[model samples]
Target: MVEQNFTKVKEFILLGFTADLQLQRVLFLIFLIIYVFCLLGNITMIFLICADSRLHTPMYFFIGNLSFLYLWYSSLFAPKILMICITDDKSISFAGCLAQFFFAAGLDLSECYLLAAMAYDCYVAITNALLYSQAMPLRLCASLVAASYFGGFLNSTIMISKTFTLSFCDNNVIDDFFCDLPLLVKLACDVKENYQAVVCFIMASNVFTPTILILASYLFIIAAILNICSIQGHLKVFSTCGSHLTAVTLYYGSILFIYSRSSSSYALEWDKVVSVFYTVVTSVLNPLLYSLRNKDVKDALKKMLDRAKVS
Candidate 1:
């Protein structure tokens, strides 16, 4: 098989979710509302974390970064989804597709590592109160978060460079709503197995490593909880871990389902639905997860509101 040069591939036709005019209208309205809610929710978390002195801790610091990541993460796909729903234009230029995937890859990748770091924070806070301050000092927390971003950037660069370099030859139509490595590999003119292998390797390292670390952190957390004598104390200690556990489950469950599959049996439709959950639903639910599950955020929000009412 002759390898077609990738430079000649100009654009890709994105076959969005559906073609029914009525369905498109409905989806457009639905996603528009969801996007608005997503933005508002993440932005509120960012604001509450920054403005409230009560939230000046390692947990909230990571929460703020997660909110920031969610903001840009949604930006990478929501607008395009809304646009395609509202209009007949379902095409994305080669550069546009690559750029969209690039930013998304970075955000999604960073989120994995950040969540693991957060789990470790919860473990330390619960397992050892005295050493918590020294173990997760402000500098160490900042460094961990920074390292996540840097690692994500490096991994995303490798994925984007390798995947985009493949020749997208004759089939320019992507079977999903967005440009992703798996789907892009399906369209490659040659050596798809090689592309698939490299992508799978990258995805595994980014997703599985963090996932294992998170699981390990939770094991320590559970052990600590069991050692506590009082039931109330156990519940109180476990409460802090609830929000992060839920967030990790939502983010990683969907991510692993989508990215872990081999190219030998890729299912675009199922992956598409799962992608919406992780990308759209997860972004909207993150703030709610933290605020609703944890008391600190909810109290901070209430105080903020009460102050506003007084003023």
Candidate 2:
């Protein structure tokens, strides 16, 4: 196969979710509502965590950072999705596509490691309750969060560099709303077998490393809970982890489902549906997951409202 050098290509045409004008209008409205809710919800979560001195612990610190991550994460896709749906101009510059892919990769990658860090924090709290404060000191917590961001962006930088270097043909139409690796790979004129292997290795490391850490952390957590004599004590201890567990399942489940299949087996329609779960739905639900399921957050919210009424 003669490789077409499309290095001169200036832009990509994104084939968004639907072509029908009515459906596009409806999608526009739906995404607009969801985006607004995501912003407000994450902002509220971050505010509550920062405002309440009670939420200064390691768990809340991670939750606050997760909220911050979602703010940027959701923002990265929502505007582009909105523009693609609401207008006929579906073109994105090559540089813009790369930028979108970079940030989205960085943020989600950060989230995976951050979630692992949160799982470990939970483990320490349950296994070493007496020493949790000592184990998860503020400086250590900050360092973990810093490492997550740094590692995420570094991985993203490598991913984009390898991906964008592939020569794309003049057919620059991306089949999805976003600039995902799979979609970009499909557009490349000549993707080496080794390159695919390398990409797979990087992605697996990014996902599985944290997944293994989480499962290990939870295994120990469950063991600790089993050793407790009273049933009430077991439930009490497990309740604290309920929110983080839910967040992890929702985030990781959607991600694994989308990426687990070979690219040849992908159903773009289903992929779009699953993509919405991680990109939009998970973000919107994260704040509710933490605030609604948490007693401390509820109490903090109550006190804040009471203070508002007084003022």
Candidate 3:
């Protein structure tokens, strides 16, 4: 069958957060500062993990991956946002939009699985203290990390493929700050049903599936915490998982709120605000949450500082 004659839209115009000049300028400054801090923080985590011998464990390995993911995640959108703020040009090429969507979705999905895996790692360590090392062996840890990246990359490919298959005609204005899948689907002129179904499938697999896994892991973790005979033991377990739980709650909660509904019902303004939480705020908070609340990471940083002083 010949391809449907669809008007090829070469570029998309991003409406951005606001049309108000004052508000846009204020937001630009705030986000620019946040972007800088997020980048530096995640990069610092990666560097600490790589340099510290004491942090050469499965847990730290995953932490490093999360850091690297955040770096890419922030990089995927920050530059474009910065450009949009500085210039009057708000149009993005069709290819550029697809590229942004691909990397952003990939990293976001990877973070979902990686966060769940990290929670599971904590569960194992807390619940099976005696065999934590043996159970989360280096090879197994490596496999899990590899699977997280592989899973993320695979999901991104599927979503992007589905998106590209859709025919875009006429409408090229996206009512969003970035090239989100749902917004893109809304812009398509024909075969909206098929595109919607494809988007729903991807959302279910990428968002809901990982959320279920993380919730189940936390359930077991909570049960294990309750079974602890001593208050001290319970506190210890809670302390260990608290940061991970906080990060998980913020990330998954925002995601669930966003993708767990129909596109027609989506509140664009509210959605953009919430999107900032996961995309930008989360990146900034992850390192602080992990480093400040995590004993191992704190110790590693101290040791690294000491080494630097001695040298």
Q: Global lDDT of each model?
A: 0.86, 0.89, 0.83
The number of the candidate with the highest lDDT is 2
Itemize residue pairs with steric clashes in candidate 3. none
Q: Write the per-residue lDDT of candidate 3 for residues 145-255, one digit (tens) a residue.
A: 788888988989988887877788888988777898778877777655766687677767777777787788888888987788999998888777888888888987898
lDDT value for model 3: 0.83
Q: Candidate 2's residue-wise lDDT over 1-311, tens digit each?
A: 97444576789998889999999999999999999999999998898889999999998999999999999999999999999998899999999999999999899889999999999999999899888889899999999999999989999999888888798767888878888888788878889997788878888899889999999999999999889999888887877788899999999889889888788866478988899779987889999999988899999999988999999
Candidate 1 lDDT tens digits, 1-311: 96546556799988878889999899999989989999999998999999999898888999899998988888888999998899999999999999988888988888889999999999988988777778789999999999999999899999998877777677888877888877787778775577768877898889889989999999998888878999898887868788888888787678778877887666567878888778887889988888888788899889988999999
| Best first by TM-score, ranked | 2, 1, 3
Task: Show model 1 residue runs off by greater than 4 Å.
Answer: 1-6, 192-194, 261-268
TM values, all candidates: 0.94, 0.95, 0.93
Report how far off residue 100 is in candidate 1 (Å).
1.2
Model 2 score (lDDT): 0.89
- Model 2 residue 103 CA deviation (Å) reads 1.0
